[model samples]
Target: MAELAHIIPASTNGPRATEGADLTESERADPTNILVLCPTCHTMIDKGYSQYPAGELRRWKERSRRARAVAFGTPQFTSRAEARAAVEPLLGANRTVFQLYGPLDDVFDDTRADQWGRHVVDTVIPNNRTLLQLLQSNRDLLTDGEKATVDIFAIHMKQLEERHLEGNWTPGSMRFPDAMNVILKGDG
Candidate 1:
């Protein structure tokens, strides 16, 4: 079942809870401050299994709204800077993900190798795919130089993906960091 979850918890009894005082009950119940989640997700957030702060929840809401607007033929005409404001946070996160990459020798156990391989196959590849989709959809909004840089980055990502599938930890593993460096430094 679907449930409406609060971005900020309702208990006005902690130091941080004081921030909610600025909002009246109606404002606190604003649709923008709520998310429709499945029962499991609702319970996870409410029980602190997933600690989503107010700011992060708000960003998710804004991204969802923008995505819906775009899908519905009502895309917002935001400036490059404004568009970057929303996207840079996501691209910045890509840099951090790369920090987890290391040499293949670290995975000595077969189980650990499987786990690491799954992470590359499942998480990293899909995440990059989403980033690529976002870039492709907004290609017209980007500068020519930005487009060229992302195009090259996409090619690099594709090559890395092939290496990931092979599950070898030699040169392909070494090249992963370099590709990420180019992406982190390159225009998105």
Candidate 2:
């Protein structure tokens, strides 16, 4: 009787320079941990010579999804200084900007960045989620004025992202305080 064969990465038949070829010990055949690969494409795929992995594109797609969830959330801080530090680094060369860093060092999606910034400003920061936790946990270390300033800064950052998403890309237009003032004065 012929046993059913399963697909996997196997020892290279022809003479290629693999250091740990068939001399390796056998792994306990755990169905859960086995990775399947095509023998002909093994060298090409393993050496990063091809754009696509031959059989499984789903794993690559899954990695991106999980990475986005980690990158697109509001940052938490242990102190007001820490909170400011996180945002301060984001304050770019005259333009307010934030970077989303993920597992693979992927760049932030602009639309997702817009949503994340707004979420932090409108819901998280204003509600004293990140800042208050920082303050209370640090023995009420943040002065009222510092908290107020951060609140204002957070709101400003939110407005900037909102304007950016809405296509108001003129200089100083994406600025948080300036944009808010314009709205208050009915200019934009």
Go through the candidates in order and give the C-alpha RMSD of each one to the true structure: 12.6, 17.0
Q: Write the per-residue lDDT of candidate 2 for residues 44-63, one digit (tens) a residue.
A: 54555235432343364344
Instruction: Report clash pairs, candidate 2.
Output: none
lDDT of 1 by residue, 68-91 (tens): 875874345345555555455555
Off by over 4 Å in 2: 1-88, 92-141, 168-188
lDDT of predicted model 1: 0.61
Could you tell me the lDDT of residue 35 within candidate 1? 80
| Superposed Cα deviation of residue 29, candidate 1 (Å) | 35
- Candidate 1 lDDT at 90 equals 52
Show model 1 residue runs off by greater than 4 Å.
1-77, 103-116, 166-188
